[model samples]
Target: MEKLNVNPNRMELAELKSKLAVAKQGHELLKGKQDELVHRFVDMVRESKDLRARLTEQFSDLYQQFALVGAELSPDFLEEAFLSSGNSANITGSEASIMGVRVPQFDFLLPKDEISYPYSFSYTNSELDASLRKCHRMMQDIIHLAELEKSCELLANEIEKIRRRVNALEFMTIPQLQESIRYIQMRLDENERGNLVRLIKVKNKIKK
Candidate 1:
């Protein structure tokens, strides 16, 4: 708790009173913002959970398809096939600010060439090619969802920090300041009453 120095003059007391009012108002606004951020963070967590479940199911299906293709196709061969298909990705990242916190923005660019997967091997049939294509598409979606989940986590952490600060000001600092202001006011009033009594005594002496 912080204590304000008691001023002899009423001018300083008036200024302190005004400052106390402003601090109270700021505390209320910050508390409201904190509540809103918490609500938004909860929603993001729910969304991230759902996205993760979907991504897991899609990935499992893709792995089963790969297994059916047989071990004859080397991992390197599959990678090369995917690469040779002219499927290249461009990932652009930017920064977005929320309540003075910077969160990441992810942009995915898939050119027309990236959409087609071509196979060079004679054993590769249309079913295999179609499965590979679907897997590639799912991979892109997974990347996008991962970025979204990460951004949400980062934002939630920042919002929590802000909430703590707001709570400190609202529940602790502002109340302490108001208490100090009241103490100062009471002390000043006492001093004024004493001075008035002394002045009256001196005036009576002069009259005698």
Candidate 2:
């Protein structure tokens, strides 16, 4: 026969019940947060798509300009122009937690007035210079959007996972535990009653 290790002290049952309540509360709170995150993530994805389209158009325009400047300017001239523009960009990442999920935060730094390349190059094409500036700005925007989209994805995934775990504990594990506890309590009561009847019978026999 398989031995049943039923907890008679009731301590384990109380502790598990407490944990079940906490798990249920956490599940509800996380579910709400998950819904919010889904909304936010959808918005970010839509924005990302629009931004990517716009960036593609801008890049096509830049390439056409590059081709127009062709034989007259070496590829080095484009590179040198970029360097001479005296603008630099730095991207940094940090972490933040939302509903027990760690998400990434990005910081962008752009420095201005680092180079006097326009006057030095003796290139009178202001339009090309303007296009370069537009490209630089677009690049920074793309980086920021990419980071936001990725973070949104990660947070959404984590929220879904936590929600599932909560559901399993609430709907399955806790109920099963409580059912087992009830069965054990009934069996113990039945055993006590049987012992009491046996003791009474023995007392009557001894009196006879």
Candidate 3:
């Protein structure tokens, strides 16, 4: 702790005390915010982990099913079927506030006939149908995972910033202010004692 560069007087002492009070209050508030942010960050990390695991499993299954379908079907037919698909997807972007951090939100939109297969069932194998259906169904999950990952990144950055500020107040600014206050108080007390001694000397001289 270092004393601030201020005159050792009552006025400086009062100012330092006031600053110390404000600093402490700020530290508490920042600490609370940091705790809340960390709690939310941990929850998001778990959610992101679970979501990624699920997506990885689903993707593996989808790839196997698609491989089987490709092996049995002609490339030209597969390309035509996929090209004829009327399904289209869109994402809408928005913002959400969490603990003063603005994170992104996404809405994955699909057509009403998204589940409708463009290719005739008589021409396509059942595996192909299943693969296509699963692909369309998992689109929303993919978007959700992206949103969660991005939110986690943003929250992590915010939490780091708040942590630094809290540390500064707790370890540096508050201690310096307190030390300055103590120094000024000691000086004032010593000055008061000296004044009292001088008054006693004056009274004795007058009495003689």
Q: Which candidate leads in TM-score? A: 3
Regions of candidate 1 where Cα sits further than 4 Å from its true position: 71-83, 196-208
**Residue 174 Cα positional deviation in candidate 3, in Å, after optimal superposition:** 0.3
In order, the Cα lDDT scores of the candidates are 0.73, 0.69, 0.91
Q: What is the lDDT of candidate 1?
A: 0.73
Q: Write the per-residue lDDT of candidate 1 for residues 126-200, one digit (tens) a residue.
A: 656757677767766676677767767887777777778888877787777777777787888899899999999
lDDT of 3 by residue, 149-189 (tens): 99999999999999899999999999899888888888999
Pull out the clashing pairs in model 1: none
- State how far residue 21 of model 1 sits from its true place (Å): 2.3
**TM-score per candidate, chains pooled:** 0.80, 0.66, 0.96
After superposing candidate 3, which stretches have Cα over 4 Å from the reference?
none
How would you order the candidates by TM-score, starting with the best? 3, 1, 2
> By summed lDDT, which 10 consecutive residues of candidate 1 come out lowest?
112-121
Q: In lDDT terms, which candidate is top?
A: 3
Stretches > 4 Å off in candidate 2: 1-5, 8-16, 71-76, 79-85, 113-121, 185-208
- Assess candidate 3 and give its TM-score to the true structure: 0.96
